[model samples]
Target: MLAHRLACTDPPVNLLSRVQALMVDFFWDRMHWVPQSVLFLPKEEGGHGLVHLAGRGAAFRLRFVQRFLTGPADLVWRPVARALLEHCGGLGLAESLFLMDLKGLRLNNLSSFYGGLFNVWGLHRKERPECCGSLFWLLREPVVRVSRFVCGVGPSLQQRLCEERILTLGQVVEVCVGPVWTTLQAWPHV
Candidate 1:
């Protein structure tokens, strides 16, 4: 319910803050000497590992945005979302979400959501070839799964590739198909 409300409306920050403060005060009253940070620490570190609601709320909002983007298109709400995206001028879903975050606009705002989506769509919009020609098209295809190409690479190596900003098979093919093969060989065996 809270997640739905957040996804639909921008709730007052003060109300949220006050609720958080009250919870903190209640905990503090019972354990006068316990540092507030202790509540947030991992259990292995001798703390309760309680999540702060404001952070959780922010995470929920992001998750909601992600689900709206990646969720099944056949969902009942998908048409509404698609219509909203179309009305915003054909923006890609993720791009629109990113722009909303960048502009400090509320994710629930249709204008911001649509604007960002349109911006992404505009950036990636390219003339479709009459037939698939070069492998380069695989890189441009938004729905292409990179995992199929990285099947044999260990998770650690994949993490390294991600950390280096080599996110796609196209990028790996471009970067690793050269002298980078030596670098790959040098990676320590797991």
Candidate 2:
């Protein structure tokens, strides 16, 4: 039930912390020696298997992101989620999410739902840096024009690329090179 609520809402941090402390206290039932985090580990790992509310909340947020990305095309929440993402920087949902740096966004100005979702997503990406090398993932990275690699490239170029439907490095390469670039040998990492 609490998981369901977390999926739909972002509870206040103080409230979550308070509830966590209460749960830990009840579990301990007296003076405790182990750190609270150890309690969240599996019993086989030499600690009680207790739920960590904040980690659970973050898991719920990641689940929401997974659904948002791969859910049925007709999902009722898709449009609302897309609109929320679009509001962040007026960019398309994919661009705002994958191309632009998540830290650069004004996350505080958005609803907690998206703010938390993006935060978790960013952390996930950072934790698994290998994901950045996958062909599908690399394709979503920004081109040199929009990326920090180039100097003095203004928004006009980005706008032009958007107008030309070339928002990513993959698109730019496809346009400049040829469709033959899709061969597996072309990208060793892939």
Candidate 3:
């Protein structure tokens, strides 16, 4: 809102000037070295580092399984997690914020560290011996955008949008776990 208001240059209420003043005040008077919102991880991970979702804009930066998440490893690294056994202890929003400034050393290995992140969704897929590993890193924005476009306004005909939706958001897009082709029910309300 501040950015938007400042961009509007109306009459005497010079939003740009007001924003410039605020920016000056923020930079000189209220500036801090680090953002307070960043949440720290346990000494086990590495730099008792932090991971915090800044705002809706920050949230949009998220992709893959990590996009919906907030806070640090402690909040998400749960032991009961379906795939990875290492993240038994889960962290949450407020509690994780307490360690914001601390920089400690994590004792765990890198594989154990991100178990909650990349491993969580594998539970639904059966291990296939014939399958090969993928070295490509995926961007989630396309998947999300495609899913929204297909599901938000397309025909429910399983033949059309259903497979597309599942491919985009995973089985969760259609509330089913089988092949994307199987779940394409005709749009119910229409």
Off by over 4 Å in 1: 1-9, 30-32, 42-45, 89-190
Candidate 2 lDDT over residue span 53-93, tens digit each: 88898999878878877778898978877877777754454
Model 3 ranges with Cα > 4 A deviation = 1-19, 22-71, 76-169, 172-190
Model 1 residue-pair collision total: 5
- Note the Cα lDDT for every prediction shown: 0.52, 0.70, 0.32
* Candidate 2 to truth, TM: 0.65
Residue 59 lDDT, candidate 2, scale 0-100? 94
**In model 2, which runs have C-alpha deviations exceeding 4 angstroms?**
33-38, 43-47, 71-74, 126-140, 144-166, 170-190
* Candidate number with the higher TM-score (1 or 2): 2
What TM-score goes with each of the models?
A: 0.44, 0.65, 0.19
Worst 10 residues of 1 by lDDT: 95-104
Instruction: Indicate the residue-level lDDT of 174 in model 2.
Output: 76
Q: Write the residue-wise lDDT of candidate 1 on 1-190 in tens digits.
A: 7656544555567987887787777778756678889978889999977667656655555555556666666678667765665333223333222222223223344664343343333344245555766544444332122223345546677457545655444455657475444555777761
Top TM-score hit: 2
lDDT of 3 by residue, 1-190 (tens): 6323222212133543465456444544666554333223434744324322222222232232342333455645333332332222221111121112112312143243243232333333423233334211111112322322345444444234334443233334345555434444443532
